[model samples]
Target: MRILISLCLALGGLLSLPAFALSDSGQQALGQLQTRWAEIRYELPEKQREAAFAGLAKEADQALASEPKAAELLIWRGIILSTWAGAKGGLGALDLVKQARASLEQALAMDPKALDGSAYTSLGSLYYQVPGWPIGFGDDEKAEAMLKQALALNPKGIDPNYFYGDYLLRQKRYAEARAALETALQAPDRPGRELADKGRREEARALLAEVRKKLE
Candidate 1:
């Protein structure tokens, strides 16, 4: 009788070990995914970005399934889909964009303040990148508002700073763009910061050179 009892307890413990290991592994995987996502954000080429995003999407889906209530996984999934849309182009892009939007919405609903306002930053970029008007998608005003909110949440976050600078540059507000870009370039360990800094400085110099030409 005692032998049987011992055997049952061992079996139960063995079964429980897998569950505990899986839970810990899932958390670790999620952390690695976030770090990889950040590192790849600026390194990926336009063509390669789609493939990378697809991989990220797959990993995120697996993580979400394993931990259904993980809001961070949802946010990562949304970011991957959104980036994929940008890479793919055409009507298919629109579909991915919609998916991305929904995923981010789900993330926000799960946790309004997940990952330092990352969801808001994603939405802001979506609005800024998509076309405006009858074609549907894109809203510069909305983009500005969302990005501002993200900044409010994470005043020194790299993404909001870089994107906001790009927005200003598009408006040809040279001085403002320069200021914002400078701040973005200075942001700690921001992916592609050095490259972006070089690009922005070159742009500023060229713009100033043009002004000089005109004055001359």
Candidate 2:
């Protein structure tokens, strides 16, 4: 259950970037991918998520076939792959995560600022969440740097702040975690993202409650 929720980390809401290169059909494809991802992550039952995410990943892959150079599409593909890996947790999922990391890295190289720096946010979350050393590629130092870069790009974005706060909480940095979650709560509502904003605020509030318990 925790993994399910954590998988949603670092996914920015309703792209705020202009995404100048995507055509009308590409934009529509992106929207479908986003809508489907949100539905699978937030609305689907936990037991059913693995299959759902697998399906979505295939859909995203098919979309990418046409718009291979679209950075935003690549980001969504990475996001879907990450969530799918979470849903299918175990050694078998490592390949999916690796693919996700590679896709996000490619997206970053193509457009670091795309989707409001979501590539950085997602990549950062992966760094902290995956196991380190021989088991996986996780590294706390790299996580912090990537997350901070994401925050620098979108200072007031809810997703970046929430992810940063979550990472801080994992490090037992309660005060900093609380501050970041508070900022997430205070983040402005993004246009066309009412559902994501509301859901994220609730998550921030839940984490804030946990952080307050630590402070107490």
Among all candidates shown, the one with the greatest TM-score: 2
Each candidate structure's TM-score, on Cα atoms with residue i matched to residue i, is 0.71, 0.93
* lDDT at position 216, candidate 2: 100
Candidate 2 residue-wise lDDT, 34-140, digit = tens: 77777777778989999999999999899889989888889999999998989898777788888999999999888888988999999998999987778788899
In model 2, where do residues sit more than 4 Å from their true spots?
1-5, 13-20
Tens-digit per-residue lDDT, 56-172, candidate 1: 778888888888776666767777777666666666677777787788788778765666676777777777777665554779898889878767876655556666666666666
Model 2: how far is 158 from its true place, Å? 0.7
Estimate every model's Cα lDDT from 0 to 1.
0.60, 0.85
lDDT of 1: 0.60
Which TM-score value belongs to model 1? 0.71
Model 1, clash count?
Answer: 0
**RMSD in angstroms between candidate 2 and the native structure over all alpha carbons:** 2.5
Span of ten consecutive residues with least summed lDDT in model 2: 1-10
